[model samples]
Target chain A: MKQIFRTIAMIFVLCLAASPSFSQTGKTETYPPIDSDALEQFGGPEGVRNWVESLFYYIMLDNRINHVFREFGNIERQIYLNTQLLQLVLGGNEVEYQGASMAAAHADLGITLTQFNAVVEAAYNACERIQLTYEACNLMIAGLAPYKHAIVTR
Target chain B: MEEAKRAKFPVSKGAALVVAMLASGLSQAGWYDSGKVLATGGVSMIDGAGGGGITPWATITGYGTKEGINGDLHYTYAPLANYTLHSLGAAVGFWDRFELSYTSSALTTGSTFDTVGLVADTLGGVTGSLAGTPINTGIEPFNTTIEMESIGAKVRVFGEAIYDSDNLIPQIAIGGFYKNNKNEDLLKTLKADKAKDWEAYISATKIFFPINTLINITARYTAANQTGLVGFGGPDGSDKEIRPEISLAYLLRKDTVIGIEWAQHGDNLEGESVEIAGLDLTGLQPTLEALGLGNVSGTLTQHESDWYDVFVAFFPNKNLSITMAYAMLGNITITPDQHGFYMSLQASF
Candidate 1:
């Protein structure tokens, strides 16, 4: 019994010892801190293009939202159009898109809040995968989170 | 031997009042809520409880988000060098308050005894049929598998492990498993104190949404020998030991998680040749010396080690989940680091 306690105590100590190094690396921020604005920090339309491309790749691999990505035909064109729309929203180009409302586009798909969360999570992971800075990734997540009400129907 | 007295955890008056009110008012409620998110119920553990592959956490089973009753049926197949394990079990959660589970495990040690020459080794010169001496009597060819059953129950005290990221408070649960091993004759011969033993545990789980990860830790006190596969506390003295286990999973998708788990096992079986080949032998040395098997040792399982696995769980939908894992059963008994494949199919509603 004492041996077991000793072993458990040893493990506790090890866990405590290892925890601080991670916190020190300073990735603990939930969202990135913005200096000027999201698009300016993202380096304009081309930068947003790479981020959207990587984000879409992760979403396509995610089982929960992948169906929605595939069901939309001409994925490459759709991706191009969406990126353009994002640029327009983030003050990039004066592009015009007769896009479907988020509600109308997803109302038939029965997207749950959980699925929307997964999409958001994928965006976060994609930010890291694309080597976005702490502030840039956080900004993207913050920007995308507002669309949950539009994207989730169920 | 019986397990130690159950550990007690304090239930705050407010929490107790809430549980009592719900139980009294919500008995036999129909069509439960899908508790938590998808695949958040966690995959079934080896003991048939809800959690990771080998450790049971605080998560309730099913999609019953916290209001209705949910049940799960699962079957797991694991192949190892010495034995193959097949477990079939089911678990049910009521109003996300209490959980009950049961699983039957079959471990086939086929030719495992042969590998150690256990049955063929000289058996104290008893007048037996084969070779005019009793066989090792451990287990012969066809009857290689040992069958055991486990019944488990857990109660969620408070908090949310997966969904609630607002507070630092983790979800806490207290649970116990009652195990009955069927091979009483084998257990008796091995000097196990009892054919039945139990394990009691308290688990805490928390989700760090910022990191997209969930971590659970369970501290278990158990008297079962070799997790009750070989029976309970042996002649080595009937005492329980605390074992700690942890499972950490990262959500790659809301419906998919990839994780690693670590669990340690205790050697509850008493050793006979405390020194022989490291088997902790008690008193069978002289007879073995006469048989030219003096160098052989560890007649019963003596040393124990930790188990680890890297696994991925995928949920195609809310009701179905599949888990695939590669396990490292490090230095269990006489084996080196043995590696194996584990797969389980779970249906929950």
Candidate 2:
């Protein structure tokens, strides 16, 4: 019917309108452009540190991916570096991430898709626990999504 | 900020305690692991498949990861203007790759038998009067519940519908369902060729994270009449034909989605003349026509229509999901524009 087609067309247009806002930060060689509002809600690098710590806390408790985390030598250093990387991901220049490239760092882990999904779930839970806005959490996940190919070897 | 940190300190300590337990070998890994993401296991479909209300998708039916198993039970009900449909089923997902399901559906035909009896009585009266004899052709009311059972299986051939958001390739799967209608005598009276048949379909599903949209397309090959509730094939031994079904959904968040689905059906039973029990209408047509009562041949030709719905699904957690929809099932049997509200409840583990 004409009404059904019109409704479908309207939804398609809305999807198109929302595409650019979520995809603008794709595949950047360096840190993405800072979103000042998101950074303010994050309460700067201190807030970023708290969120990373919360994320690692959940990661260590998750049986699916916790064993992989146990293989790391220094849990505190891993948390510190992840906080710096997350800060850069949110467009903050407060710290530089000194860890290896995502592919190289994860190459030896033999992580499966299941484990990667578990990690993503944990990250989302951490964002929620930190009381981040819904859009901010989605934007953060979108920024990190491209690395799945590199991190998930199987 | 200080208060927040203080509140989270116990959580941090608990994590450390759990890690210490793991270090001391005090924990045993559980057998079942619901590691898949939320809402990734889609809601249970009407036919017990894991998909939208009517069209099946490529995703498996539960929250299990590749290393474990998961299953769920679902109940769906639709109350249309002329009839009501009830479906109940269960499904199991194996290693997140293969799925098996069973569903039993019943359709209650309201006011259909009375209308048939009224037509039969009038024809009998006219023909008997012309022949100088009184005849009775009234049919007794019978059980009007048409029941069908479906057993289905699906295997994921390739691709991933979720978690591979970096690519454009969608998940693809192939599946089939064997259906059996329980009303054998009624099917014979209705001039159907068979009471059971097979329906096979291949589905492709993809989620575009950038737009927060999910799309599923399926091509089904079947000879079923109104999804086999009325029976299968026609009086002419109808061959299986291909039809298309599609579902498009937009994610409001990770746990909720609003969507639309359209499923096309076949017309295998259309234009077929029917034979009512204890009535030979072919012999009475001439007598009725001679009395100027018009031709009284029982030409029971019914047309079927495509089914579509607009739905919203919400998953409060990984264990339970609820879906509500406005369904449009046009021209079912003798009824026109059979539209109504549909609701389904699913519990997954």
Compared with the true structure, what per-residue lDDT tens digits does model 1 show for residues B1-349?
2344321222133234334533543365554445345677788998888899999998876666444677788899989776788998777777677887778899876665542445234443332443454434345556466788787889987765643332345687879887777766545545566767678998988766545677899998887666787677766666888889999998776567899999877665433322222232335556556666665554434445678999999998768999999988754344445579999989875
Instruction: Name the candidate that leads on lDDT.
Output: 2
Q: TM-score of the B chain in model 1?
A: 0.81
Docking class of 1: incorrect
Runs of candidate 2 exceeding 4 Å displacement: A1-54, A60-76, A83-97, A107-114, A130-136, A149-154, B1-31, B117-143, B271-274, B277-301
User: What fraction of the true interface does each of the listed models get right, in terms of native contacts kept?
Assistant: 0.01, 0.20
Task: State the DockQ, from 0 to 1, for candidate 2.
Answer: 0.15
Model 2: pairs clashing at backbone N, Cα or C within 3 Å: none
* Tens digit of per-residue lDDT, candidate 2, span B141-249: 6537778877778998777676445454568888987777777766765666787777889898987654567899999998888878778787668688899999999
